[model samples]
Target: MLELRPNCECCDRDLPPQSAEARICTYECTFCASCAETVFAGVCPNCGGNFVPRPIRPENKLLKDPASTKRQLRSAPCGARTAA
Candidate 1:
């Protein structure tokens, strides 16, 4: 199951469970659309994989499988885009 991380790993922007702004890599490293597009250039910093929009769990399903409240942030700001 997707962790559906609560915030952008790069910019620490809030990304709620249903946020369309959330993007994730295959490894599920989450980021906001801005960071994923502009900062990382669609490439994941932690992994070399490309990013895609994170699936939003249905509201009812969220009650059974809760969206992760545990926030993750990068140790440092994602500065430069890495080569894909």
Candidate 2:
């Protein structure tokens, strides 16, 4: 399952479990829509993959599965956009 990370890796913006602005790569590297589109150009900085809108787990199911509270903020510069 996707970690459904709590914040954008690039900008450290809060992205709650149900946020439509959250985007993720296949490897589940997470970012906000602004960072994914403008900063990374729809590319994942860590995984070198294209990003897609992250799926929202249903609130009821989340009680059982639980969205991750762990944050994976990046400390280094978000480098060049990776090949999609």
- Tens-digit lDDT track of model 2 for 1-84: 777899888778889999999999998989889889999888787878999999999999989899898878777787443422
Stretches off by above 4 angstroms in model 1 are: 80-84
Candidate 2 stretches with Cα past 4 Å from truth are: 79-84
Among these predictions, the greatest lDDT belongs to: 1
**What residue pairs clash in candidate 2, if any at all?**
none
What CA root-mean-square deviation does each model show from the true structure?
4.7, 5.2
**Clashing residue pairs in candidate 1 (N, C-alpha, C atoms within 3 angstroms):** none
Per-model TM-score versus the true fold? 0.90, 0.88
Give lDDT per model, in order.
0.88, 0.85
Candidate 1 structure lDDT: 0.88
Model 2 reaches what TM-score against the true structure?
A: 0.88
